[model samples]
Target: MAQLAAARQGTHSTKTRAEVSGGGRKPYKQKGTGRARQGSIRAPQFTGGGVVHGPKPRDYSQRTPKKMKAGALRGALSDRAREGRIHVVSELVTGDVPSTKKAMAVISALSLEGKVLLVVGREETTSWLSLRNVPNTHVLSPDQLNTYDVLVSDQVLFTKAALETFTAGAPTGKSVKAVAAESEVEA
Candidate 1:
């Protein structure tokens, strides 16, 4: 997944002499006046000629196994949980419309500092809207959740429904009740 994020593609390219335009006719005949022979203007020896041994586009992405990616996600979750940096709320936003004030209030209430990753369920549009406007807070659907977001955030906040969806798919993981309990104990 991380590799997908950073394919960091190499796009450098230069046309080869054969591919360069205006090179069909020979620049000078083989038995020419005393001057170096040039097959065409596009030949490497000529000015404005094509390059040799130039770089072309390439993919730097590596194939990572599904199990490895899953394990990485689990590891990120476990680290945050161990530190008690995870929080869950019954609801993300109370109002029907987008409200930055309400979103700020939630963060203040949770006393979360630094970058925060708020995982909301698919149906929680208002919650996403309200919170996304707040700086330093990132809103994500449970399906969009990944190890990068989990590891980067100072605190991970999830609505109840989103929490269920996140942990439900993990293997050898804590129950929601246990998660909440563990968070409280550490906090």
Candidate 2:
């Protein structure tokens, strides 16, 4: 949550009375008129004046433990699952080529609406291309899934291969050589 908050653009800013333009000197004398005395024309009570106690540009981030970030992601996934917004498919057919039409058909068949987060395997480039063109749909590999995307999306669709690989857990620092060696043992 801290990281997500920091990533947001905090450009909201409002000038104070001092920062407002055209407030060079006092607008009127202190004991001149029978009416109330006046200070600068840019005071908060005046029209076209600076806002009082308004928002300002500032960082909205806090340091978080590594475990806490992981827990947040877990929480988001569980929430989506609890809401019954997760769907799984064995595979998507775009014929021998990437077809956007086929992707729309699949979405309509599943009765999915709103922004859809489609997760497929890294090897399924065609599947990714096919669905990426659909309106309000985003395609990503299982490894690219994150808390922000999961939380923002209304529906989460996972291909069977991607679901299995993602459920296996994130990859550690092990290199391809180490992983391959593990798969092949000595005689």
Candidate 3:
């Protein structure tokens, strides 16, 4: 199957430019000070040089083509799936809403232990509450998913919505648990 690109929205703006300061005036007077020929105090030589503080503020946001974005997301998901780090779920709904008990039950039912990264399709008050109390369950929306989180844990779980959001670019509409089940070899 064709997969998305491995890049994480890398269509960065090429317009970004660094701002430099200092180096305008001459420092200490030449000739007899017995020291170096002084130029601007901001000459980067004097302790107070122009901008020892570094560049000023600017935008870091990047723009990628729609096709690229979708492709990259798909690729990332596929790579993780191929590595056996991804798990797909039918849904994440629990009878007790977002109860810790319900969350624990799901974990136990699924036999998910250790650090689990749960990628939900959208936000949910219950999933937040339910998973929050769990020791190592990290919950986040599909949009927030990233490589760092993927690499941090041994596995990744995806709700059906999250999977769709990842593979098909769909918006999450309800609460669902997408869990990454850790292996016994690591435990």
Backbone clash pairs in model 1 (N, Cα, C under 3 Å; residues 3+ apart or in different chains), count = 0
Q: What lDDT is reached at residue 183 by model 1?
A: 44
Across 6-62, the per-residue lDDT of candidate 3 in tens digits comes to 333444432111223545655557798788676555555545444455444444455
**Against the true structure, what is every candidate's RMSD?**
4.8, 7.2, 9.1
In order, what lDDT does every prediction score? 0.77, 0.76, 0.57
lDDT of 2 at 82: 72
What TM-score goes with each of the models?
0.77, 0.63, 0.53
- Model 3 gets an lDDT of 0.57
lDDT of 1 by residue, 65-119 (tens): 6677767776787788889888888886786887878878888999999999998
lDDT string for model 2 (104-160, tens) is: 788789999899999899988879788876778888887777778888899888887
lDDT of 1 at 15: 89
Candidate 3: count of backbone clashes, pairs at least 3 residues apart or interchain: 15
Best to worst by lDDT, what's the order? 1, 2, 3
